[model samples]
Target: MASYKYDIASGAEAFTFNSVMRACTKEVAALSWCMQHGLIAAKAVCSRCAPPPFMRRKGMHWRCSRSSCRVERSVRMNSFVERSTAPISKLVMVIFFWASGTHVTEAAQHAEVGGDGNVVEIDATSMTKKQKYNRGKKHADY
Candidate 1:
């Protein structure tokens, strides 16, 4: 028997790679989805306050609602998105492809070959024209 560090499914999201990828198609959607997955921080804190506390959002960015200390916080503060330059949709699509049992190299290839890298298109085709995706393990070249 082998020991595993993680389960096949994270929670209620059974076989949810497709759904998660779909959810991250937009900026706001990506933020919310990442927050739900614990991949990014959803809330912000006031920096001007003496003790510093959680802040409320005025719009796209968070702001200290207190009239005396109305400091604004960038949406990317302390979040993974702050450092990443890649498009959120591409990241989500790659993650989905990876979670769906596709290798990183294969995922890249799939993305290039299949516009937007949707799972259906990626899964529907194979790298080599000779070896079909679902037919067998032996590659055509081998």
Candidate 2:
């Protein structure tokens, strides 16, 4: 598997939609990409065991390496997408769209917002800004 380093400083100008799509075409690839981008942790320690066993990748979850302690932890734990149920690919696309300043509706469409009975609700209230300290147009007397 190839490795990828996504520099946020470079911005969207460094990557095209096709490139991002190709990089995250598979679940493993997407996970790897997220790891490279620091969006996910590559290693985890099992909290259930004393002396903390190292966790190994077991499908979508991490399993404790100790034979006696078979504890499991989500790969997304403490990551940027921890609460998100969306597929890694879709999430990556959404991130790309957001970083590129694409319109919310268009970004949602491109990212295929929801799937398999999953619902994605977006709050755009923060997207609009209020004039700070009433700095914009002032009210005039009639």
Candidate 3:
């Protein structure tokens, strides 16, 4: 697994079972095992208990070796419900906003992608050569 000893031993308040479960896939057996063995808490009562394979690094990316019956998944894949569509940067922004104690409306305002207070539509034909150049950073110098 991704040896989360850093989180466990950080000396601040440690993650609870609920938080760990939030980061895990809905693999009931593994979740139950974590709860029963106290791996959900810092200073696990059973640290030697094997972690699921998906948490382990096989190469540049982590993946499970079990093809017959998959029981594990990466934290990223497990943590978010709609990970494919949303950009990772946006997800980080949400986490950052949550941690910083900012209200959701302010965060949404800061991360605006579409129009202003009123909808400002754009068209491909309206984009001038200069605008396109600026958009592409064509004037950038090394």
Question: Candidate 3: what lDDT?
Answer: 0.43
In candidate 2 the C-alpha lDDT for residue 107 amounts to 77
Q: Write model 3 residue lDDT over 3-118, tens digit each, in one string.
A: 55455556323234334334333444343434344433211111233553333433222344555433333333434423555543455455556776879787776557454565
Question: What is the TM-score (0 to 1) of candidate 1?
Answer: 0.55
**Pairs clashing in candidate 1?**
none
- Segments of candidate 2 deviating more than 4 angstroms: 1-16, 104-109, 112-142
Give a tens-digit lDDT track for model 1, residues 1-142: 9987976565857237566656756767776677677766677778779787788865447888778888887666686567667766566677678667888777776455444544443254555656466676666553
Clashing pairs in 2: none
Total backbone collisions, model 3: 0
Each candidate: how many clashes? 0, 0, 0
Off by over 4 Å in 1: 1-15, 98-142
TM-scores of all models?
Answer: 0.55, 0.63, 0.27
Q: For model 2, how does the per-residue alpha-carbon lDDT over 5-37 read when each residue is reduced to its tens digit?
A: 977767554368877877678888888877876
| Total backbone clashes of candidate 2, pairs 3 or more residues apart or in separate chains | 0
Q: After aligning candidate 3 to the native by TM-score, how far in Å is the CA of 17 from where it should be?
A: 28
Candidate order by TM-score, decreasing, is: 2, 1, 3
